[model samples]
Target: MSAATSRPRLVVGITGASGAIYGVRLLDRARALGVETHLVVTSAGVLNVHHEMGLGRAELEARADHHHSPGEVGACIASGSFSTEAMVIAPCSMKTLAAVAHGFGDNLLSRAADVTLKERRRLVLMVRETPFNLAHLRNMVAATEMGAIVFPPLPAFYHRPQSIDELVDETVERVLQISGIGQASPKAWAGL
Candidate 1:
């Protein structure tokens, strides 16, 4: 597709995970790259954004090209026909992970992810939990088996990040790279 016609669209889902900043950063990056974004946030995600980033729902929704209600299962993104480059759940909660792993489409976020998987489009889950139990491990495995890329926002010290924002940016950069929408980054490793 030509540049004018091929604006890549990405579906971003934010859940109740601790690192709501990841989702925020992803939106900023996608916007900078001229990518269209469809965003969905769980109710718990709204609470976490307030608790963690002090951002209100309107502020968060304002960052995206379109925002879908969590309960809006009939939304355009819920269908496989919606042409998107990929779907990513930054700070993917264990609850969201379990729902997606089991094909649970209770909400628009999960339904969009399910549609992405079935349509063979890229689906990346930035699972934001630690101290994984057996169930979490199994859920990750199951999601991977179903063609989801389970990414944890593990800190990388090799770049010697000076601040938390740098770390978050680097992780977001990597996430975009995995989705084939990466931007040039100074932090990218040059290899030893």
Candidate 2:
């Protein structure tokens, strides 16, 4: 919990993946839920956000409570003593996944993930790639064995989502709940 507001601190990482919207939406939903978010967006992540959502770095960073550069290895989130509740890499790219899986702390994002894992905190990776190859599968298995949750952001049809926004919101809600962050109104399954 954050010392200032006593709110749960969540570390969010955005990579150069296809579904940049997931990261942005997650930040928005977390903020609405009163979660303190520390954002780390890679250069490619910024480019993808601009291309997919037309959001500049400033606009994207504005959605979070704290923003850290990818190169800032000395950021607060890089240390387990910083006391983050969890870390989520929304739309986690194959490259970033590999880095985390291999324990490579080359950038602030990966370093924060390493810290989260070392602290035994929840580390959720919303891997975005489809039709994964053998290498991707191995990395995912390794990360899972190392206690990271691999969430692929697959849309649930049981909720009967009417629009893309609904689907995204539901997925973000699930992510929040999985990260131990409270969901405002979770859509629970009711058997017919």
Candidate 3:
């Protein structure tokens, strides 16, 4: 539909979580769909991305139309008026999750996510932690109750992916659906 071609604006937040590839995959999918993406990476997030995806700053930034520093408040995505369609904190650190859940907008990543919730736009937090304690669950619940989506980096075995990329693509495709792209960008699951 031409209406969907209006291009959704995405705010991607990369935290210091273990699985950084999710954020990269999200950016690539958005770019491929001609969606405008605003990328903001925390210091730990940068290290995680290089460790997981071997993507340098330039290469990663190239995947998005606009890139901002985690500390940069002037970034267009920091304001509630910026009109972002959604914000996804892929590989979202538990620290970041706790911060946003408690209204602690210390940096651009948290601030952007806060703005996303305030604007009633989609806010998907890919909580990248394992063995979640009660505290972590509480934080996630608080975020979800406040209109944020807490998607864990859990891979589904139903797809029977042959490689890591396929598994990654399947999860990333599901996340993309949250942004309104659905399976049209990545191969959709049509029942094998």
Candidate 4:
């Protein structure tokens, strides 16, 4: 089915950052919401996912409607003509952020992100790094200036989340909402 007729398409990129669960949960949640997903995982991303979640590449790729190799620079997503609502790099590594910040389309993931930005589509970078150094902060600023939302998956205590799943789900829900594909019942912060 065509994306417009059936479901909105979202490009998901998973980098080598520590929080692999964010990317995985994003795929699952987007599917539940009937959104078509195009996944691209870097090699380091695959390794980290396996190390963190014990999920192999095939297992992880199975969560999405379509998956692309990082080296597939000629993939449909690499072009601006490809219609996609938005692209989110969940757990975006510092290296990936630098590439996107500098307009370096070294691979499919960064290339797709560049396309997303040039097309004026939403490109959310869920950067996962602690102890932000100068370069990391600068790259984030550069990406933000270029219309990429640099989102860090920090837990919110306002929701009083009881479990890790709840925390992750809440964060993913926020991301979906930000990407303009929000769920029917999104959790809102009712001021205390």
Candidate 5:
């Protein structure tokens, strides 16, 4: 069956990274496209949303089709058999990135990510830290070697984004495009 005939399920993990809006916008796009989303957020993720996006917990949770607690290790998405198309940790904190790299699943978000990797499913981690130390670089390499896509939400200036929202939407669109679920809002380059 085609994608339209079957509902695509995506597990979204939001961490204590600086770009909480990336996660929120991903949810909005997924919802708009009729995709099923399972959301899990670390405590710091919620705090980041309040600080960065000025959104409350209820408001953030309201965007997703389902919400899973970070501490809820037994959540359905934590199992390999749950069958999600992809798991994206938008604005993934370095702490969580390290955990996933070292095979540490101390919470629901990491556990779900671990399950995604072990299941050979697409696991996209938008690691959101800069000025990388050797350790951070190594962790990113390790995660990549283990099948997780270490995507940093870098702004593409070629899009000539007029506002922060445009930048965010383009980044979210690019990430979701990996799962064939969202539109590419940025103008494409026809030739180099």
Candidate 6:
């Protein structure tokens, strides 16, 4: 049995944030569902994932079908014709959020996201900034207006996850839903 993705390419990225596990679980789950994944991690994302999720770059790299340097400007993903269905900046940082919202595309991740939005393809950003300021809220609104989903990693208590892994998985699942591949491995949820 294999994943049902038809030319289904998923672009997964990690940014500097506290919830690196969200990005990890999203990749893991995607792999289990047999999605061909392209991964890019910012330098800040590498440090943050080590400090927060305790996962090394090698581990993250292993989960991806193709790994592109965050700073590399020549990766295939920087262009729109690479045949990627969507891009998810899981645990999206404020910096990356602003970049994508404003179409900065300074880095490969942001550029890929920009391409996603411009092509009208799905782009899901799991924005993790709490105590949102006016600027953050406005960016979220702006990104949404530009056809991007700014997902905040707020967990629901209805499922009552027993451990941190479950909490992380819940958030990943929530974020994955917007990616169109979420239904492939959905767990039990309440209220249908």
Per residue, candidate 6 scores C-alpha lDDT tens digits across 1-192 of 113446468899899977888888888888877778899999999999889868899988898888999788678888777777688998799989899889998889899899889888899988887899999998999999999987788777787779877877877776666787745544655575
What lDDT does candidate 5 reach at residue 41?
A: 92
The residue ranges of model 1 lying beyond 4 angstroms of the native Cα positions read: 1-5, 182-186
Write down the lDDT of every candidate, Cα atoms only. 0.91, 0.94, 0.85, 0.93, 0.89, 0.83
Best by lDDT: 2
In candidate 2, stretches whose alpha carbon ends up further than 4 angstroms from where it belongs are none
Q: Rank the candidates by lDDT, best first.
A: 2, 4, 1, 5, 3, 6
Which digits, one per residue and each the tens of the lDDT, describe model 5 over residues 1-192?
Answer: 124437788999999989999999999998887788999999999999999988999999999999999989998898877878888999899999999999999999999999999988889999998899999999999999999998899888885789999998988888887755644354566665
**Position 113, candidate 5: lDDT:** 92
Residue lDDT tens for model 4, 1-192 = 234556888999999999999999999999999999999999999999999999999999999999999999999999988888899999899999999999999899999999999999999999999899999999999999999999999878887899999999999988988987855255888986
RMSD of each: 1.8, 1.0, 2.6, 1.5, 2.1, 2.8
* lDDT (Cα) of model 3: 0.85
CA error at residue 50 for candidate 6, angstroms = 0.9
The runs of at least 3 residues in candidate 5 whose Cα sits more than 4 Å from the true structure, single-residue gaps closed, are 1-5, 182-186
Name the best candidate (by TM-score).
Answer: 2
| Ranking 2 against 4 by TM-score, winner | 2
Candidates in order, TM-scores: namely 0.95, 0.97, 0.91, 0.96, 0.94, 0.91
- Which runs in model 3 stand beyond 4 Å of their true positions? 1-5, 182-192
Which one wins by lDDT: 1 or 5? 1
Look at candidate 3 and tell me the lDDT of residue 133: 94
In order of listing, the candidates' clash counts read 0, 0, 0, 0, 0, 0
- lDDT, residue 128, candidate 3: 85
Compared with the true structure, the alpha-carbon lDDT of candidate 2 equals 0.94
Residue 165, model 4: lDDT of 94
